[model samples]
Target: MDRFIECWNGLDDPRTGNAALHDFHEILAIAMCAVLCGGQGSVDMGLFAKSKEPFLRGFLRLENGVPSHDTFSRLFRMLDTEQFRAAFQRFMAGFSEQCEGVVAIDGKVLRRSFDSASGKSPLHMVAAWGCEQRLVLAQIATDAKSNEITAVPKLLEMLRLKGTIVTADALNCQRAIAQQIVDQGGDYALALKGNQGTLHDDVVLFLDDPASKAITAEPVVEADHGRIETRTATVATDIAWLNKDHHWPGLAAVGKVERLRETAGKTTSQTAYYLLSAPLTPERFNEVVRSHWGVENRLHWRLDVVMNEDQDRSRLGNGPHNLAVLRHMAINVMQKDGEKGSLRGKFKRASWDEAYLARLLSLF
Candidate 1:
């Protein structure tokens, strides 16, 4: 995407010259592509590029062109990240159609890089991943030291939310964020926690008030990790936390859980409380609200465990944003490729198939 790279630069070409990669562009792109295909580190990128020399030489202007690991680092360090992320949003827009249901909004830190002395900062990015659409709709950077409270709303504004439900964690369970989602023509299922004293207390009180029962005999049967399990659960309450002065929006019902788990001839149980963003209906609220954790497990877990993304120090200049975008794009592409279910499997597919890997980046 030479044209894309140029467009992302977003500055008029000076009469002096066009800001081109001067052949180094292709190398960097190729190298970045290799990295996304499971290059472990700078050295891994170099080796991957070398291994593909014969194939890369065909489409890339590799003649008289070679980039050391430092070249990759310095080049990414020079990129205008915000401009690029905007361009990336546009590039990804065509692929990220609003196919259906609720979207998940969350933030994460590249924690290991927080203290890196290489001038790379730890990153806090708010991402809106459409579970139903199977793609990331938008992502924005939060200040490395702060929460994503402000950034989350901004990121949602960039999205096309015709029939979407935005789900976030406890930190985002405020009236403003919830109202923002409604204002954007979307619904929210934000988790309630101790962060909001009044709301948390109110929900707890409603659940504990001896009458709110949200789930009844909700039995979930599924097979996972070579095991078959059945879960029968209920939601009943005893109010000890709700206050008279607190206001809850779209607050359907507050309740507690009673989960009985049976597996391998052993039966265990659990109980807890939850605050609902929508009306309290056993089928709808129980399924969607409870399923919110699936987003964290399915996406973020894979990002860390398989892609090793959170461990990287790609935070200089726009390096953090660019790398984050690339990583998300890679996951989306891999998910669509039909060969892999997990991030590691996708990387394996890319590493095994150079042509397939090329196809992955060509979309960029």
Candidate 2:
């Protein structure tokens, strides 16, 4: 808690002299606590502050006696987004251990944040997900005109990914991005699709050719939730035979994964390829590639389903972006909480049990 407070203190106060009645740190503390306990909007935050006044007073001065819902909305809108994002990263750094497993980078849209008056579309945020820990490491907001490609480098620049394996979808499979990962002391496992024109064709031809000497692995089979699935991954490390015309930076090998699924007597099959900088075995390559989906499942899905982020309607100024950060922080807090049943269950407990809320806050 002390470390988080210190980090929050580092943010530049957005208010002018004497214009602020409430302490900036206290406001954020209340806001974060509210979100951790499943408060969705500014009104919910205000109500939470009022209901938990005693518990809040124990730590916070509450000098102004819990700012109004309007105050909460205004403060969040007035907050400097870049500084707030940096502070969030710094705050999360205290809890982040050494990153070593698969780190997947992806983007999500705040669906209802578009403002017709301001002529703004929905906000697009690129997030980095820690697959093994099931945690969100960092995020950045991108403009509607631009895509994740531009925002990805900025997000990568903010993270410390030494010894970690980073993965991304085909949109991010650029030569410069590959080089950036390797330059940052990390390895890349980027998906290869039609975007890479000739390179994609070459990979497909190489994998399909029976005469080609490629390393192959036995198919992995699984049965779960009334479905039977089988996956087979193949890696071709010997890429020197390819034409020298298309030179990919840090490219060590190419891989292909075939998925066959059956349900209710129906069957389907699909194949996907990847460009890898890490010299992983065929099996490990499959594992790393499969782990990339954790970003969609663990982070994006949870935010929409569990936290109701998609249904949230806070679209003014920095409200959408800042609230997204708060939601990320809440997820991290609940995930760190020991003896958790479900995320929703933990949130309910935090709301009703002050002791549990205190324990959650203690994780700092």
How many residue pairs clash in each candidate at the backbone level?
7, 0
* Model 1: per-residue Cα lDDT over 57-140, one tens digit each: 767777555556655665555666666577667657667655357677878776654545666557887787777656766788
On TM-score, the candidate that comes out on top is: 2
Give Cα distance to truth, residue 36, candidate 2, Å.
0.7
The lDDT of model 1 is: 0.64
Candidate 2 residue runs with Cα over 4 Å from true position: 17-19
Q: What C-alpha lDDT do the candidate models reach, one value each?
A: 0.64, 0.87
Clashes of 2: 0
**TM of each candidate vs. truth:** 0.80, 0.96
